[model samples]
Target chain A: MPTPLYLATAVAVSAAVTWGLRALPFAVLTPLRSSAVLRYLARQMPTGIMLILALYTLREVRPTAWADVVPTALALAAAIGLHLRTRNAVISVLGATALHVAMSTLWPA
Target chain B: MRGMRARGGARDFAAAAADTASVGLSLFPLGISFGVLVVHAGLTWWWATVFTAVIYAGSLEFLLLGLVASVTPLGQIAVTALLVNLRHVFYALSFPLSRVRPLGRVYATFALTDEAYAMTAGEHARSWSGARILWMQALCQGYWVGGATLGALAGSLIPITLHGLDFALTALFVVLTIDAWRTQRDLPAPLLAAASFALAALLTPGQVLPAAMALFTVSLLIRYALRHRAGSPAPDEHRHPVPAVPAVPAVAAAGGEG
Candidate 1:
């Protein structure tokens, strides 16, 4: 074993887990198709979970640090604003990431 | 009969390629960036190919690049994978896998990536075949894997170490949040999410992700019950076509057998 896992094990486990998640909805679609509760969840969970997931990614940022906070906040705003304007995921995400990367490297956090 | 079958397959292949060309062009560069990031994070180049080839979940793979470099417990990795990929479980609600011939369903489901789903599961895909959907997904994966391999090969030869690269994941989630909100025209859901997550974080301290998801799920169920009691279960503002365009019906169509 490669300590935590053999290299192949890590690959297989992640692959298996991902495949299982992707396949799950279809596997159970017969029963799930008629459930109103599941229907509500399908409508509700994406936006809700996505918001939480974004926050989870940023959970560690220190709210008090001006240099980091300013850029991080601005980057998020720019991302959201740019997406609203363009309705394009690629431009908004890449453009915001590029702005943050430049700031972190040149402007310095 | 043979000639017609051959021609239909060819046309399906070409149409799928054309439908995916623009998306594929963008996927290539992002895949390259993923490859470069993997090497910069000190994982071997083969790790990039193995991950893109096998796991194939784009953002989760980025998260895993960090985990694989550390001694993060395998149990945690499994949980993280579940949370990150949970959205796909819903994508299946409207994904055209049911239209796919039974034998192809397994591979089709395996490759049901965000890119693949976005391309294939929409109002326009009503007439698409299992073979066409399969091709679109395979091409998307090829572009991703090819770009990642190229990026790793080139990245390994260079000495660039970029900090704050992890910000890509944050940017990605933000994009998804905005899309999910726009698709549903649902503003309150995100507010409820913020509240649920904050409560979970404060109350549980550890186990925030799963705890928050559970809290959010409960909140959704409560909201659903109230709406049902109130009569008519959908928000009024959601009367506008769920998609501004045809490309985003997965959530809107989720309440159906289609």
Candidate 2:
């Protein structure tokens, strides 16, 4: 086991670095917020970024197995459908999540 | 006036809390998993608390357990963190940090996770106060930290059958993506995202996320340049009319989208 001092140092380093990474954009973007480039990005990037994030989250869901694909697809459809119908994010997330958890448990893939 | 202000404050708090309930439910289970992992990795429960409180970034915190257990070099940890979280730079492009108070903005910036960004993005966030935003962020952090602490303390008692709870994050992202797509109706955005994911997955499977983001950024810039050359007005120009003399600063407009 590492010494207590070393462990403390590790935690501190991790905290500082993590916090710094989170803070970097804010510091860098404060000055450039008004630039035409950022303006364009502000308007155009949201949809693209959200898309990227959703796909990225599902990157590991290979289609080799029905069990692997079915629950997630169904849950995603449920989420979309509920959101489109209710226009409530909380309901969509919760309802879909409950369905996913139940499906995963029942199917046991 | 004071009574009215207090009531307004209560209303904002309630709204912010209500808005984050789904996220809170999702994060708590994940946080518990993180706590269990930290302890399993040979660290104390307090370490989980520290990680949750100080780092606050979910995926990075998960990775940190292994890094700490292996005693990875600080420089390596810092570099890994920077790459893992590089997407936050993109999030900052449209995050309404400017609307928040200065000191609150600092904390807001620190707490701006993927869930927080997703919750606050699009048209709904435009009318949110700095108070509501800050409150929402604080509640998120609270859920994470509280859950981590609980897991660390009673991790052994928790059953191992909670297999698919992690899907909550993915589901939340899907919902947010749908919301964003509906709000913007920008068809090429999803296509570009797919193209970026394909390129990144094919070329750099290990680093698919960052690679995908970089590819998307480049593709977006190219599309923007093309549109500019074509003299097409911005899609959002109608929603936000530019003043004759520039009354609102660019930063104010930066919060308009993304």
DockQ of each: 0.51, 0.47
- Classified by CAPRI criteria, candidate 1 counts as medium
Q: Give lDDT tens digits, candidate 2, residues B123-214.
A: 66667888999999999999999988888877655545455666767777777777777767768867988899899989998777788888
TM-score of each: 0.79, 0.85
lDDT for model 1, please.
0.73
TM-score of chain A of each: 0.79, 0.81
Candidate 1, residue B226: CA error in Å? Answer: 0.9
lDDT of 1 by residue, B1-258 (tens): 999999999998999888777566556767888899878877778778988999998878887887877756777888888876766776765566655666677788788886676555333566777788888888889988998898888899987755555566677678777766656766777888999899988998656766787888888888888888888747642564322122333343333322
Model 2, A1-109: lDDT tens per residue? 6556776776677667656656666656655766676666666666777777777767667778787699989998998899889977778877887888888888887
TM-score of 1: 0.79
